[model samples]
Target: MSALHFDEATHTYTENGVRVPSVTQILAPLNDLSFIKPDVLQFKRDLGTAVHKATELYDLGELDESTVSPLVQPYLDGWIRLRAELPFEILGMEERVFHPAHRYAGTYDRLVLLDGKRCIFDLKTGAMFPSYGPQTAAYKNAVEKASGKRVEGRYAIELRDDCTYRLHEMTDPEDWQVFLGCLALHRFKNKHAA
Candidate 1:
């Protein structure tokens, strides 16, 4: 097994003691969230993060529902609703994976058997933006590379604030290429950092 470490504080990954950029980091150059005010952006980031943690804990059977904060309850409910509808068997949750060839790493939300199909997933607590496709594509690619098992599907489950979710099938063939392009640009920019 390769030594892959994810530092939660910095949202970074290190493989074999060498720093490796994450999917989001590589795609940051093209992610224009600038329209959101800084404070609103921070709040959204925090809420999304909290929801992810709560959902992971719940999936692992470690969450105390009673302790769930009211602020994140709706998002959790959205996830639960999705579970009720899809009825998936969880194979992996909050899994950290790295692509040896691309040298990028990311933590995917879940890998599941949905209707007997192997599907990799990403959970979102906000709008299902166009970027989600590439984000999930990068995750699917990394997970497939780290594990020999083939991932037959890629999805983004957007959990809204009102206890509802929309499932998006990321079937676009160009999404992975988009992420790879971002990675290349990131590398070039890093190499020429002033």
Candidate 2:
């Protein structure tokens, strides 16, 4: 296992002198077109980042609930509720892992032990989409490859605006294969574009 560094200027990950595609970058081209303005998407992305940061702090036992900003409070409350419902022991959070074999890298949300089951927990502050399966599966594969730990299940935890959350278990057997296809397409496009 190797450390992966993200260069903000280039918006890409590099490990061992090799540039690798992030999981989101690999899946970006497949994102559905939105009639909604680009600003809305940007807003959601920003909000998602805030919520994820708050959740990470909370999970690490460092979050001061009263200090959470008003704009992200609802999402924080939703995460609090979901946290109560989850009985898993958190093993990892917001940790970067890279697949040396596939040459891809990503930061997985969480790795947990639930009822003696090792699972990958991906937190999403958006609507559930089919892409999440491949996205989380790719994270799972990377983590398992890097840590030598078998992940028995993969779940998408969606934080909603109403202080609630929906848990979706990704059960697709071919999701990892699909993600590999996306990675290949991403490399092909970048190579040809250059």
Candidate 3:
């Protein structure tokens, strides 16, 4: 257990020997609609904590009721069971390096291999939104680049609200190109800052 260290000056996360740029750090210059709502921030923290705890328990082979909120417990349990019983590997648990123009670093939620097919997943502790499609597409691009192979599908595990999971195949290469363009721009900007 560690405290969340915040840089009052930069508002970034600095803990566990990792520097996590605040949401504002990545979104501030991109657009005006980058404000982090209170609810969204809370959900993000909770989701990350839940995943971390689940991972620890998995390593120890411990199976018990999840510590996450009841509404999201089902999804957590399902993931644990699936991981234990199914033949799949979660690859994105390892931190990946990203060199972008404006953004030099970022991490994906989860990249997995299931049934000999690559899968990219972004777990959400909230309701599904229309924008999730593009977000998942971005994850697909990130996973593909990091793994040097194409992903068969992108998915979002909505743990709360509707508690639904959605999967979509990446049929359009153009979408991936757009995502890469964004990463390039982010990397460029970061280099200029450096």
Candidate 4:
């Protein structure tokens, strides 16, 4: 069996001595964020990191309510509200997984049982995008292989700034194909890079 290690500082994974690209990295070709300013983008990215940490703490029952940042409180509220609306049993949170066959790695937000079916529920603080379809699908494939559980569904939940959420179920199997295509393209580019 190949060894896998996740470095928290870089949010990266190395499998059997090889550094692997993540799902987000593979999907980089789809990103068109040139419209957003650099400083604004940095702030959004920082907010996302903080919010994800808060939610992970909450899931692990380690969150100190009093210490929650005011800037991050709204997202936590939205996440909490989402739990109330659609109750789920969490199987894993912020789990780093690697797919040896594909030579890639990623961290999934939540592996859960929602509506009596095992599913991959990704949490996002930003607007729901089409790319999320394949993003969650990739997470599903890697998670199922690592955990030996058949993911029955793929969903992405957007936790809004107004404490509301939009839950989207990704039902297209082609999303997996899309992710594979992205992965292939990513590998090709990397291999031929100067």
- Residue-pair clashes per prediction, in order, are 0, 0, 13, 0
Top-lDDT candidate index: 1
The lDDT, on a scale of 0 to 1, for candidate 3 is 0.54
Model 4 clash pairs are none
Q: How high is the CA lDDT of each candidate model?
A: 0.89, 0.88, 0.54, 0.89
**Whole-model alpha-carbon lDDT for candidate 1:** 0.89
Candidate 3 lDDT score at position 170: 43
lDDT of 3 at 167: 42
lDDT of 4 by residue, 1-194 (tens): 86888887987778987889989989988788888899998998899999999999998889998999898999999999888888889988888888878989888899999889999988888867789999999999998888788999999888888877888999987999999999999989999999
Report how far residue 88 has shifted in candidate 2, in Å: 0.8
Q: Rank the candidates by TM-score, best first.
A: 1, 4, 2, 3
The total number of steric clashes, by the backbone 3 Å criterion, in model 4 comes to 0
Candidate 2 local lDDT, 10-123, one digit each (tens): 778999778888999898766784765899989988899899999999988899988888888888888899779877889999888898999988888899998899999998
Please give the range of 10 consecutive residues that has the lowest summed lDDT in model 4: 121-130
User: Per-residue lDDT for 57 in model 2?
Assistant: 95
Query: What TM-score goes with each of the models?
Result: 0.96, 0.94, 0.55, 0.96
Of the candidates numbered 3 and 4, which has the greater TM-score value? 4
Report lDDT (Cα) of residue 137, candidate 2. Answer: 92
